[model samples]
Target: MLDFTSIVMTIAPELWLALAGLVGVLLGAVFGDRFNSFSFKFGALSLFGAAALAAIHLSGGESFGGLVRTNTFVNFAKVISFVLAGVALFMSESFLKRHETIRYEYALLTIFASLGMGIILSAADLMTLYMGIETLSLSSYVMAAFHRDSARSSEAGLKYFVLGALASGMLLYGASLVYGFSGTTSFAGIAASDMSNGTLFGMVLMIVGMAFKISAAPMHVWTPDVYEGAPTSVVAFFASAPKMASTVMFANVLFVVFGAAYDQWQLIIAIIAGLSMIIGALGALVQTNIKRLLGYSSIANVGYGLVAVAAGQEAGAAALLTFITIYAVTSLGLFAGVLAMRRRGGMVESISELGGLARTKPVLAVMLSVLIFSIAGLPPFGGFFGKYEVLRAGLDAGLMPLAILVVIASVISLGYYLRLIKIMWFDEPTERFENTDAPVMGTVVLSAVVAGIVFMVFISELGTGGWATYAASGLLR
Candidate 1:
């Protein structure tokens, strides 16, 4: 008989998120139209609470009959994810109140998404991973279209649903092939199987499917369109948390199930990384919309993370975790800067709208510069170190070609980041652009960006420390 206590511990984080989501739904419904202004604040606090609880569990033992494990890495990732979610919620509040209804369903959807990501990290089997992915994806689809009043939002939702379904089908089909080849879906069981005489086709298909989820190039067609059409805050959430969850699960798929087949998967990831880098960097050059640019940027960032995975060593694993950590913070900061833009006296959209922003909003301009520079991989900042570590890991693995491609991609990406900086500081304001008398949520979100940039400065200290090192150890082992 299963001990209920163990089951409770194993699923504690999911349960906490779920409970919080349910409470949010009820409270939001009860408050109805009365608390529209407060909806976002309520949601952010709940997510922050869930993050705290997940951290507490990290210092404890693993649970769920060993099918799910919680440790420092998962905890740290959860905290990062939850923090991003909170910022997403906070940034979206003003937009939601102005453009759409601030409903309870939005908060519920985000909570469920967070729960799904938490489950994915703890999963010990391919089935558990699939369940987690589906849960997260389904909620995300709804969140993408939450602003049903907007044609773009509705279109984004439909596109995401169609593309996401195709990806999920591919993932399931690949999982079946893997089970057929090895007769098991558990990571440990798959690792123990002798695939010596089995066809490599199944493993290749599985890797391709996982690559699709991570938006690694050729499979990234839907990303930019969706990012442009969906709400900016949702795009920000998509850019960071989901990518981390999906990447971690993909890493688990490779390291745990196919550890013995390293040479084959390593080459595959290297190719994907190269393709993603090229597409992400070149694609962003033509983008005029901030969200679309981030879509392409996200593709490149995933490539960066995959560089570490291709290394197939402990240092590579550590680098992967550290890169995602820095990227999440930078991502949050960038979105906050986007939110800070006032359009027609509201939230601005086009790149041109940022002209002379620095003259009027100096603080926001500086914060935006920090985020853009970080994203561009500039030094004396975290992005620089993050890229350096990944390149070093790839070099250690004798992957000089992939390393070279990463550098080229970063060079190509400079155009957009630099354009933003130039417009803010040099150009004169086209017109008086004051929306809200005061930027409330924008300020709060920028505070998060500042925190992310500060954390980057101390990356070396934390990257090699207890939780970060320990988390990397688990993935490699």
Candidate 2:
């Protein structure tokens, strides 16, 4: 029998976000254009509230008769998702206002998406996972096409919907197979079942489905188009929070439920990781559009994080968390900088448009450069430490080859990152980009840069008290 109180406790954070989304919808219906000014603030409030609720439930337990579980790991991921959603919302306000497409629906969809992420993190059953994925995917599809007037935006939405639906079908088919073979949908039940060929095949299908969600390569065809076509603010949200939730969910399912079959799955994950790294590095070199470049960059970064996950050990789990934290902060900062790049014509996406930015917006140039370098995993920044931890974890797990490949990919990636920096600093000044005053975005970029630079302090402190390790332990338990 499931306890009512336990069920309520398990879903508290999601409930808060859902309620907030409803309120946003109602406000939009009632106030129309008048709601634009309040949408961002409301959205931030809801996300923060949900994040606090999730934090309070860190000492989680199974609920709804084991269909859902909440623990330090789930809570941690949910909090990060909520906070990132809020940051994305804050970053979007200026962009939306500038584009004259400011709608309360954007804020509403973001909150709902965060709610979906919370569900995914807490899910303990295959059905629950699918439900969460659909919720998140549906909201994201709509948000991508929010600018209905733009042909590119509409195309982005259509492509995402079609691809996402296919992925969901694959996931569902895998779930059915798992259920048929193991006679259960619950993680604990699945873990207890004997490993069979059918179960392994099912797991592979499920992984392929999730690979699409995280924009891992081969399944990453939609990412560049969507990133380039979708509104910049929406892409920022898409790249950060959803990726974090999906990646963590992938780790949870593999490490917790499929631990008995580690050898079989490890190779699969490693191959995917290698492919993503190579594709992302080489693909970005020729990209003219900044969003498409970052889309590829995201794919490569996912590969790096997966290296830790493939380790399938406590150190690897800790490293995965650390890497994601750094990635989330830096990605948000990068997109925030991108959002600030408006000119008299409109928002600029071409890399060439950023030439001579140093002359006109020197501060923005420096911030963007720091973020790019950090993404390249250069020393003295959080990205370096993030990569170090993951690579070290891979080495400890005896994955020398994968670690080396990651390093090579990182080197390859530096070419484009540096190219961007050179254009910003050394190229002759062009027509100055319109001096849009996006104070919110500026603050976000500054804060992220500061955080990235100082994150080593947190890592040092981790020696005495291993929060990441503790969180990883919860997942295994």
TM-score of every candidate: 0.93, 0.97
Q: Write the residue-wise lDDT of candidate 1 on 37-114 in tens digits.
A: 666677788778777777766643455555676655566677778777876776677666677667767777888898
Measured with C-alpha atoms, the lDDT of residue 218 in candidate 2 is: 81
Q: Under the 3 Å rule for N, CA and C atoms, how many clashes does model 2 have?
A: 0
Candidate 1 TM-score, true structure as reference: 0.93
Off by over 4 Å in 2: 1-3, 462-465
User: In angstroms, how far off is 19's CA in candidate 2?
Assistant: 1.3
Off by more than 4 A, model 1: 1-5, 28-31, 34-39, 59-62, 196-199, 435-453
Error of 1 at 285 (Å): 1.0
Candidate 2 lDDT trough over 10 residues, lowest sum: 456-465
Across 1-477, the per-residue lDDT of candidate 2 in tens digits comes to: 647877887889988888898888889999998998799999988998998988887777788778789888777888888888888887788778878899888888898888889888999999888888889999999999999999999999999999999998998898899889999999889999998999999999999998999999789999999999999899989988888888898898898778899999999999999999999999999999999999999999999999988898665888888788778778877877888887777887889988889899888888888888888899877788889988998998999999998999999999999999999999987676877566545655665555456675576543213666667767766
CA lDDT of every candidate: 0.78, 0.86
